[model samples]
Target chain A: MRRIKCTVQYDGTWYAGYQVQPNSKTIQGEIEKVLEKIHGKPIRISASGRTDAGVHAIGQVFHFDTDTKFPVEKWLPIFNSQLPNDIVVNHVEEVAGSFHSRFGSIEKEYQYKVYRGPHKSPFLIHHAYHVPHSLSVQKMEEASRYLLGTHDFTSFCSAKTEVEDKVRTIFTISMEEEENMLTFSLVGNGFLYNMVRIIIGVLIEVGQGKRAPIEVKEILEAKDRRAGGKTAPAQGLYLYRVKYSNDN
Target chain B: MRRIKCTVQYDGTWYAGYQVQPNSKTIQGEIEKVLEKIHGKPIRISASGRTDAGVHAIGQVFHFDTDTKFPVEKWLPIFNSQLPNDIVVNHVEEVAGSFHSRFGSIEKEYQYKVYRGPHKSPFLIHHAYHVPHSLSVQKMEEASRYLLGTHDFTSFCSAKTEVEDKVRTIFTISMEEEENMLTFSLVGNGFLYNMVRIIIGVLIEVGQGKRAPIEVKEILEAKDRRAGGKTAPAQGLYLYRVKYSNDN
Candidate 1:
């Protein structure tokens, strides 16, 4: 048996997200069904992240154990032929069996896109959230800085999450604007449920003058679900990358 | 009556294209219906180009005749309230009576995005074409030069086209690549039916060594349907912009 790692890209629009739930049409279920057909055996694939519904991914990583010894080159075309149009297998490589996509991941990066202009766009409706107002970038940046280090992010995480530890390390969070688009990239050792979206929601409030930049600290210390920020919409969230070390 | 020039954006995935047809939904028709409802008058919108099915647009110029003197700023929210989520009315402004979206347009630009790698994706299935081979960019650029300037583009136009003159001027044809995504931007005075698609198809052939760079001129002069390449798939094309000179 050999472990094969794959880098995947998906337009998560019509999907029920990346996880496989019983009797649900999902990204994993779609790929798993196709893989079963190819291997003529049931195969369970493990992924770097289990993205929520309507969230997109450009460089998601996953791994599967296969008994077949097909040439490396044959994996792509054959896998793509069976996958749906909204998802594709971008790369395939042999990896060590000890490598675990989720636990071994050293960092995860996410990006939130905003079309901040008075004009609405049909083209960007699916890819970005349109905010037809003047937002203070300086305020947002100031508020985001408080999230750069390790902290107990209970106030920012989704209240429904089952994780026991609320403390996580955020490596960096930076926001930039170009023409009609504003992008926010967040890098972290790990993220709690709805963390990025909730952070953006609060930052937007700060940018709009409704909240003070220093209030970010108050919210972080509140340790309450409603203390941080509003959750940004799902459409604007993209799982940019999941990084795993080679030695793993 | 006032002639209003509006910049529009739309995801052509859901509609038949930009033109109105019996039993079909189109970007123009959808906007016209919205305007009629807002003003309680008969209105017809004319677009700068009639994009084919699944071809998106970012800055598609359009004009509509209206009797109501409603403020232009009000048009954004009112029309957007009535328009579908896939279509956006970005800007609306008063224009001279002489202006026509199609006839007065001096330049039109289009972009085609193709994803090239060993694997294809499922999520972007409806938006881009998956090509799993490396393309020679140098050859494509070399052949694109042959497309510049005035020429009879009958070979590049679709056989279904009904235009009397096949000659058109191409201002620029350039290629840009980022990682696994490759984009072809073609800016020209005008285009025939399926012209951009055919040009991309021919360029792809040239990039793959299936044809030579100089063969583009031969294809243009042939004025025969069998002389050129196949029409690219509709999903990969985008109507980026259409331009008009002031005081024209």
Candidate 2:
């Protein structure tokens, strides 16, 4: 059996997160159904991570083992033809059987988009978080600097996160502003549930002058979920890319 | 009585069209419903023009006569609050009683977007026309020049158009490419029904090497609907702006 790795992109606007549940529509559920149809049997695929509803992804990765003799080149077109319009299989390749989509990951990058337009744009209603109030990007950048490097991100993750270890190494945090849209990019070894969204919430408050830039340090020291501000809406978040060792 | 002119924007993904129709959801129908709620009586609005289903608009103009003593400044916020999230009221101003939204328009600008990505992007499904095939933007520009200036656009309009006088003046056509998206902008005194979309269809054919650039002149000279290739999809088209004399 060959383990095939695939990179995917999805809108996530209509999905009930990525995992399969009883009756809710999900990205993984749709993909597995398509695979089952092609393989003539039930097939389970593992993803790098799960994203909440209304979140988008540009380079989410997954893998499934299959014994079908279907040509590898034909997989892209056939899968795309059968998959829903909102989910696209971008790249597919044969990988070693030992490669795990989830545990084998080395790093991940995420982006959050904020529309700073004075009025909400119809085109961006679903794709971006609209903040009509003015913000200081410079101040937000200052606050983001405090988040770079290894730290216990307990305050930056959801209270519901079940992981026992809240420690993670953040490699970079960058912010860009273009055409009335503010994008925040974060790269890290791994992320806990809602970690990026909670960090963004705190940074936006800094930008809004509700908190001082240096207050980010105190929030991290607090090491409590209550120290984090409100979580940003899911629509603004995007799983930009997932990086694995050896460029897998 | 004051004739209030308002600039509006809407995402037409869900509406039937811009015109009010029996038992159909429409942009005009939604706006009129909100206005009637404010005026305590049924009110009617006249638009600069009508857009087909799935067509977006960034700067559509409309006018309504009302005797209510509502403050002009409050109209912008009040209308926006009541309108659906897909529609936004950008600006509002009182105009002369003689002003007409449809007849008083002098120029209009329309933009059509074509996505050149090799794969469909989930984010742009409703906003851009995805043409996975490579297109020659230079050739499309060359063909667009032949369509500049005054011409009888009979062949470039929809066959169902009711207007007898198909003559219209096209001032300019400009092409801009940014990232994987190509935008074609057209400015004209007025446009015949489906004229912009039909022109885009023919220009895209030229870009695809299906037709030569000079052939656009012959198509116009044919003065028959069959000469025009196809009507490009409405989703890629946008009513960018409408201009009137004296900026009223």
Candidate 3:
């Protein structure tokens, strides 16, 4: 048996989410179905984390143990051929048996895209959140600094999540704007459920002058979900990249 | 009555085509349905041209006559609110009664997007043509020059088209590449049915080294549909812009 790691990309528009659930189609379900067809048996895989419905991913990582003796290079073409149009297997490699995609990872990066035009673009409707008002990127950057570093992100997490440990370390937050498109990139050791979206929602309010940039410190101290701004829509979020500690 | 002109954008994946048909959903059909709802009667509109199924448009122009005396600036928001998510009315203006969207147009620009990578991208599946081979953009650029200037482009048109006049002037053909994505932009006085796609098919053959750059002259001189390469897929094509000679 060998442990294999795969880089996955998907358009999450039609998926229920990343995890398998009864009576719902999911990214994990789709990947497992393809693996089951190839191995002639059930195979379970572990991903870096779960993404909600309507959230896309560019470099989602997953690992699984397989007994099949097929050459490692054939995995990408084989899986991509069986996958649906909205999902693709980009790269695959045999890794150390103990390399866990979730627990062994050092950092994860996510991006949230926003279109700030008064009229929403037809092509961007599925990929970006539309904000008709002009956003102040400078103000948003100021607010984002308050979110950097280690903290208990309970105020930014979803109450629906049962995980009790809300502490996470954020290393960097960057915002770049071109034309009417604004993109926010957040890098951290890990993210709580809905933490990135909630952080963006608060920054947007600050950019719009509805909330002061300095108020984010007070919100983090509150440790309540209601203390932060509304969660941004899932369609605007993406799992950008994942980093492992043993990388070259 | 006011002669209203509008710029349109649409993702053509869900529609049959741009023209109206008896039992098919189309860009024209959707727009007319929304206009009929607003006017409480039937209204006909004329577009610059019809785009085939799975073809997208970023700056499609159309003109229609309306008697409601509604403000021109309100037309875009009103039409967009009534249209589907895949279609949008980008801009609206009141044009001269004699100005026609098709007849008054002096130029049109179309773009063809190609993704050159071994693995298909999920996000670009609906928007670009996936070619797994490494393409030579320099060869394609050299071959494109043969297509410039006025010519009888009968060989580069669809056999199914009933239009007898196939002479059209290509003002420019430009090739731009970024990473593994290649875009071909062609500006012409107008296009025959399937002209842009057919030209791309020939250029792709040149890029792949299946045909020499100089062979394009012989193909154009043949004036037969079989002389040129196969028509490229419709999903890779986009009507990028339209131009009119009259004063703004």
TM-score of each: 0.91, 0.99, 0.99
Candidate 1 residue-wise lDDT, A215-234, digit = tens: 99999999999887679888
State each model's CA lDDT, in order.
0.86, 0.94, 0.93
Error of 2 at A221 (Å): 0.7
What clash pairs does model 2 have?
none
Q: lDDT tens digits, residues B1-248, model 2?
A: 99999999999999999999999999999999999998899999999999999999999999999999988888999888999999999899999988888999999999999999999988888889999897998998889888888899999999999999999999999989999999999999999999999999999999999999999999999999999898999989999999999695
Best by DockQ: 3
**What DockQ do you compute for every candidate structure?**
0.66, 0.85, 0.88
Off by over 4 Å in 2: none
Model 3: per-residue Cα lDDT over B1-248, one tens digit each: 98999999999988899999999999999999999998999999999999999999999999999999778988988888899998988889998899999999999999999999788899998899999897788999999999899999999999999998999999999988888888989999999999999999999999999999999999999999999998999999999988998835
In model 1, the number of clashes is 11
